[model samples]
Target: MSYLLRCITCGEEYEPTETRYTCDKCGDLYGTLEVIYDYENIKIEKEFEPKGSIFQFKDLIPATSHTPIDQSIGGTPLYKFKGLLGFDELMIKFDGISFSSSYKDRASIIAVNKAIECGADTIYCASTGNAASSLALTAAGTALRTVIFVPSTIPKGKLTQLLVAGAEVIPINSTYDEVFSLSLRVGRKKGWYCRNSAINPYLLEGKKTGAYEILIQNDYKVPDYCFVGVGDGTVISGICKGFKEFYDLGLVDSVPIVIGVQSEKAATIKHVFDKGKPYTPIIEPANSVADSISVGNPRDVIKACKYVESTGGHFISVRDDEIIDSIKEMSRSTGIFSEPAGAAPYAGVKKMIRSGELKRTDSVCIVVTGNGLKDTDAVRSGVEVKTYDIDEAEALFL
Candidate 1:
C-alpha cells in the first residue's frame, strides 16, 4: 500500500509527508498531485468479491484506515437499460443514493477522515452545492467543523441540507470561482483542512471507488464508454484514475472511454479540452440551470483533460433545455430521478448518438452524480400537476 504523491503538471514526486496538497514548484491548481501506488508490491485476490462500501478497496485508497464515518458512502447500484436511447446497452450508475444524495459523499468521507487524521479541527470547502452538502453531511458528528463557501445561485434544497448538517454555510454573492478563491485564502489563513476535491489529491482517491464499483458490478466487464457530468472535473478525473488502477492490477482488460458531459452555458472544461493546452482560468460567468456543474474555472482542469485524453475520450457540452429534458426522460424511462447536472450525461449521450459520434452498438455507462430532489426547481417545467374535481372525474369516467 505504499504510495507517493506526484505532481500532474510537473514531474515532481514527493512523499506523503512532504506535501499534502500540491507541489511547491508548480503551485496552485496546475500543481495538483495524484497518488501513485507501487503496483508491483500491491496484491489483490484472484476472485475479487465486491464489497458494500468504498473501504473494501482500501489497498488502492491513500488512507491507512478503511473505516468510514458513513457506512453507506458507496455501493450505489448500476442499473441496466436495454434499447433505451437507441443504444445496444446502456447502464446508469445511480450515485445520488449516497448519504448526502450526491456522488460527492464518496470524496467527503475520505476528506473528513483525512482532516481528522491530520489532527485538524476544521475543514473548509468551496462548492456549487452537492460537494458542500456532502462535506457537511460527512463531517457531522465528528470533531471536525465544516465550513462551506457556496455561490449565491445554489439551490435551496442543497442549502437546507448544509444547514441541517450543522455546517457553517456562507453563500457568497459572487461567482463560484470567486467563492473558491475566497474560501481557499481564508482557509489557508485559518490553517483549516481544505477539502476541495479539485485541489485535495486524497479526495480524488475516494471518487475512484465509483469506477471500481462499476467494473465490479458488471463482473469486470469494462464498458465501451462512460459519460460523467463535469463541473470542477474532480469526479471524472477520479473515475479515470480508478479504471486505470484496475487495469494496472490486471482486473479489467481495458478502461472505458470516459466522456465528460458539461452544460454549454458553463463549459469551461470542454473549452479547455478543445484548446489542447494547459488550463487558463476563465473570466466569463457560468450561468446554467444545472447549478452543480456551472463552474467557469475548474481547478482540476489539468487532471481532467489529461485523464480523459489518455482514455481517448472527448468532452461534450449540452444545452440547459436538453439537460432539463433529459432529467424527465431518464426519470420516466428508468424510474431514476437525477438533478440537471446528473442528467447532463444522458443529454450528452443523446447529442453524441444524434451526431453519429457514438455508435448504437457500443455499451455506455452514464454516471448520474446527484439526486433530482437536490434541485427540483431546475426541472419544475417537466413536472405536471393535475387537480381533480370529484364530479368532473366521475362524469368523465361515466
Candidate 2:
C-alpha cells in the first residue's frame, strides 16, 4: 500500500512522521518533493488509460484522496509554437491559463482534497503570486480557510486576485525564503495543514498532470525536450517523476530531456549543475526586473540539478530583456499573455535557437506557468492598448 519515499541527496527513507512537512534527518533543505510508490501489487496485467490525468493512473499519485471533483485545472491546453527559430517541430504546451491563471491551481486541488480527507479545517501556504492566488481560489471553492504568506514584490493583478478571494493574505516584506520560513514556523506552531509546495509532497501529484497531459496530447509520445522555468523546483521535479513513470510503463521508448530555465541573474539550479555537487544557495540573488523569478538560494536547487544531469538536459539562462521580448512575442503570436517568469521559457526557446542548440526535427515544449495578468507591469514598457472613437483614433494613426 506504500513505498519508501527516500531523500534524493542522502537516500534516507522516511515515514509520515508527526504531521511534519519533511524528513527530520535531511530537513528538506533542497525543497524537493519526493514520493516513491510500490508498483509491485499494481496490476501489470491492467493497462492505464492515457487520455486523462491522475484519474487514468491514480496509483502513481501519492495523494491519499482520489477525487474526480475538478476537471478544469489539470487538463490544460497543449499547443505548438509554430515557426520557432532553429526548430522545425517546436511546440509549447501552455499551462498558464489553468482554471486560476496558473499551474499551481492543479496542485492545490489535490492538496486541498487531501486536507479535506484528513479532517483539516484550514490550509496554509507561502507563495510569490500565482500559487497564492490559486490556493486562495481553490480554498474558497472547497469551503476551507486559507492562510497564505506571499512576498511583497508580487504584482497588483495577483494581489487583486488574493484580495478578492476568501483568504487571509499576508505579505512578507522579505525574500522568498523568509516568507517560506515564516509559513513553516506558523504552520508547525498553529497546527495548520500545510499546502505549500516546498513543505507538502502531495502538491507534486497535481503538478505531474501537466506532464501527463502533454504525453496524452502527443498520442503517448514524449517530447524531445521539456523546458520549465523554476521558482521552487516543484513543477520540474513533478514533471520528472511523471516522465519516469511513463518510461517505467513502457508507454514511451525514451524520456524527454528536462531543461531547467532560470533568470541569468538568479541561476541557482544552473550553478549546482555546473559545479557537479550538492549546491547551496548563495546569500545574495542577482537582480532582475522579472520579480517572479527573483529567488535567492532556491530550496530545490539540489534536486533540480540532479534532474538535469540524470535526464541528460541543459539549463538555459536568459536576461530580463529577453523575458520582456518573449512576453510581447507570445502575446502577439499565440494570443497567450504571460508574466515575466512565465515568459522566461519562451526566452529559453529563443536562447536555444540563438546558441544553435535546437534542432529542426526535435519536438519541444515550454511550460508557461502563469498568466501575464499576474505581472502586467513588467510588460508595460510600451504604450497600453487603447480603444477610441474612429475619428480620433484614425487621426492619431495617420
TM-score of 2: 0.91
Model 1 lDDT on a 0 to 1 scale = 0.89
Query: Candidate 2, 75: how far from true, in Å?
Result: 0.9
Q: For candidate 2, lDDT tens digit of each residue in 1-398?
A: 47556676677677744364566667767534477777556653235343344545566665554344465556667877667655666667776667678888878888787788777878888877888888888777776789999988778888888989868989978877788889988988898888877577778777877777778777777898898887677788778777877677666778889888888887766776677665664544655666666777566666666766678986878888888999998888878888888888889978887778877788898888888877878878664787889899889979
Q: Which tens-of-lDDT digit does each residue in 1-398 have in candidate 1?
A: 68899999897998986126898998877898999999998888645445578877878887644234556778889999889998877999998788899999889888887787788889989998999999998888787888999998889999999999999999999999999999989998998999886778998999999999999999899999999999988999999999999999988889999999999999988888898876555555689999988988888999999999999999999999999999999999999999999999999999999999888899899999999999999888667898879998898879
Q: What is the number of backbone collisions in each predicted candidate, taken in the order shown?
A: 0, 3
Give the worst 10-residue stretch by lDDT in candidate 2. 44-53
- Most lDDT-accurate candidate: 1
C-alpha lDDT values of all predictions: 0.89, 0.75
